[model samples]
Target: MNLSIFFEPLNEDVFANLEKPRTLGSYISYFVSKFPDWRAADIAILGVDETRGRSNEEQAEDASTAETPARLVRRKLYSLNKGAGRCQIVDLGNLRPGISLDDTYLRLKEIVEVLISHNTIPVIIGGSHDLEYGQYMGYEHLERVVNMVTVDSSVDMTEDPSVPPNKRQLRQILMHEPNYLFSLGQIGYQSYLTEPEVMATLEKMHFEAYRVGEVHRSIQEMEPVIRVADLLTFDISAIRHQDAPASEPANPFGLTGEEACQLCWYAGLNDNLTSLGIYEYNPELDDRELTAMMIATMIWYFIEGFYHRKNETNFTSRHFTKYAIAFTEDNPDRMTFYKSKNSEKWWLEVEPLSAEKGTRIVPCSYEDYLQATKGEVPHRWIMTQARLG
Candidate 1:
């Protein structure tokens, strides 16, 4: 019911801080152009001003302009609201001399506050994962802040000085909130986090993690774990190296290209969702066609699920899906195949006992899972299909 746009300036310092260069804006623009429906949905962008870095010849030409502001400027890019869509551009020039994190946070906070007040979900094209700290802070006003889900190859919880400045100080977000906190598809385990402390911390917090194989095994088991989530943060590193190879660690594992897009689509399908972010991509690492193609696909699927979530998104039929049980109790290990054509949601599509809805005791370890499958029976839905708010 409420919506607007905001922009964040990106530049070299931002790159230096984040350990990656700006890559999301143009891709987003391309995406909007490709799928005009999403353009009609929301408008926002974040980046640094390029005008400040204009070449000598360009600066001279600008100076020759009759208008003072035109004469002073060199280059800057803003979000284009070409039609009924609200296109808001948030771009900045070089850090004037020097800027503090406090200043940066303040600037970001102002825009975030507006989104929160309007209760509008933000689809962020990130500058750095550190921006997450500020983004999380903005949601404090909510009575219940949903669990935070971060998908990356490394634990990112490390704040090693040797690490780049803009790299996520991921450890800071690790706190027990009586909320459902989880991470997935971390592949560069040994190299990125080589300490017992990291594993111990997750164990202590009851946080579960997955390497590629493990995450896949748990994919069907994720309905309830994900149902409790409040917001989703995708580091892009969760993407395979071939798809988004420019991530901070640049090492991605778990899931194939199809699986990666499925994750984005599923995350957007959650009902209790607040916002989504895709971060840690370095355009500099990509060639023209390959790199952009991968991230572009991710965005496309993300928007796909979001649109479907707006409705009950259903399909006549899809491949049979499995909903894993949390425990091996009376319900032994098994997978439910949807023999009937029903709800398209992988989880909601399957019926535990019979082909009809409301038959068997739906398999779920958590309450959100039960709620997520509110309308259907067991084996009829994908875990992600039901658990979201």
Candidate 2:
């Protein structure tokens, strides 16, 4: 696919003042005078300037005049020093917004699907959170069940006609036909902001939702949740307003800047994660570009984590420690677990309900193994079993 046709070449004036030595901009293949050769790139940076998803007309009008949120983020990202990894990155430039919001979604979906099919991970920046629905659609033709994780303050499941697409995109994903979504895990949702019925609906679907306080208490626990995902969508609103004030509905209480980056790091290390979208940033509301800088740092951390991936999925290898626990007394049902010697990550094997289904190796934490050793079945195990059935 000729991706350049769908994109607008980045305005050089936006980044012209940047000093290139040792900075990320020096190492990146970007669209300036001509489109970069993205075919060989390992990571493609995509910018989306669409914001019509916002219900507030005033906010949308302001976005039209202000510098695009994506450009602001790119400026900050380019100024950071390059990481340890040899960068095979390409900045595809901002996608041209279509005449209608749904048109924009289809364009994004097509671009993301093509990028993933070529084994290039797309690091999407800007746009409203509803754009994630397009990101989710990218996986439709991949011929596998998808696991998704979203970091947001409120569940975007509103049924009200007055609500904009950004506020109800999750419902669209859930009801999307040909249902390839196997599991969805939400992180950093504030209880007060979420509706009780939405929580109940997610529970009924056998999905996972972690409260903001729960995530903040032990951010490390989120590693397993992120590791199992095939895609991750982060809403800037999930970060505290003080840290990321540019969001549509910036919350007073949410993940700290540090915690948000930590989650991105975990997402980067996951071998299964193919695409990432960070959304809902409005440059008009930013305080001296602090929110833009924060988003840039989060992207930097994700790239650092990507370079540090251990690729330790082989359980039978000598680099892993295996444990067999008998969780039942009468039938003595056995469970197998593996811990990576290199990265110290954990995984457990769950037996499928039928022969055709086979066994599943699920990402887990050391704490889960401790629970199993005490003659208890871990909740994660039970959840996986239910989903498999």
Candidate 3:
């Protein structure tokens, strides 16, 4: 179902989030072209608005019962037929009506399964970080894939899987075998997680992350952490509190709008980027000029990432806009880097020459580094940097 056509009034709650001076859609229409490149040809974007609240939850009453307000999914004609390559955007905001969050997730999964089986990439936009419960579930059958990345401000690590009214982290649900899930950008920590060590546990599992201070450097420097994942799962909250705060994670850590776009571009360019999801965008908390616009622009960045891969283009300029604060910690199992042949997932990959081994780069680290596998059975580390600006 195409979901981006319809325009609706903002919900009453999260009114504070919507306290913007201008409209966001307008901003998206204005500046999407001036951002990161995404792998549009290789990866398809599915924008789903399957967000819902339980009858007992606080915002349950605010959901719209509309069937098809504006369905982008319907318009694209991105079928799962043979040779169905390329990522398509599926706006779930209209596909299913009045379904529980669980059911909605299942419904989304059915569509995703169809795409994945056809060897088409699914760049999913979301209802919540919770929807991934089903996304992760669907990935089990894919043979070559076994990794998922969560780019957000909070870990969502608490364990309790009941339902809309009461649910928990993947630790509660994905219990069978260990999954290669990583969490980046749990910066600007607030009360969402009960403990600070939740971050530590995630790191222990290789769910690496950065604080507000760490991301201050260029995203170019931090690429190693996320490069390891098969799929890059982006939570909109990963953006800063000032940048895009209309989503579930309003108070995010470091990284500017450009870095977020770059990361999405990285996903779009990657060859192994099996799936991508961007979530927690609440119209309630967005400013017409800032939040929503930022989202739309970011969406363009995802596309830009893909396009660059398809055309083998370079950024207008790439001197690391956010590289001042790249700090490297004393990581025992610190990541080694690698290089790629410019074809990132959508088209993004890695490549690098022989570099001395010193673990983390001292001072502020470069965010451009990514974790790529080079050996047999398992993966080996090789350091890579983008074509110098």
Best by TM-score: 2
Write down the lDDT of every candidate, Cα atoms only.
0.43, 0.89, 0.45
Query: Candidate 3 lDDT (Cα, whole model)?
Result: 0.45
Better by lDDT, candidate 3 or 1: 3
Report model 3's TM-score to 2 decimal places.
Answer: 0.59
Candidate with maximal lDDT? 2
In model 2, which range of ten residues has the least summed lDDT?
56-65
Q: For every model in order, what is the number of clashing pairs?
A: 33, 0, 89
* Candidate 1 lDDT over residue span 174-229, tens digit each: 54244333322233233343456776666555455556565566564554344334
Q: Could you give candidate 2's per-residue lDDT for residues 1-389 as a string of tens digits?
A: 78999998887865676776889888889998799988899889989988888873433333334698888999999899998788889999988887778888899999999999998999999688999999999999988899999999999988786888899999999999889999999999988998999999998888989999999789988999999999999999999998889987658899999999999999989988999999999888998999999999999988888888888777889999989998666866788999998888899998867677978898999999999999889989888888888
- Candidate 1 RMSD computed on C-alpha atoms after optimal superposition onto the true structure: 11.8
| Tens-digit lDDT track of model 3 for 30-82 | 11123112222244444456555322343223335532111222221221121
Query: How many clashes (backbone atoms < 3 Å, residues ≥3 apart in a chain or on different chains) does model 3 have?
Result: 89
TM-score for each prediction?
A: 0.56, 0.96, 0.59
Model 3 segments beyond 4 Å from truth?
Answer: 1-43, 53-93, 160-167, 172-194, 252-254, 310-389
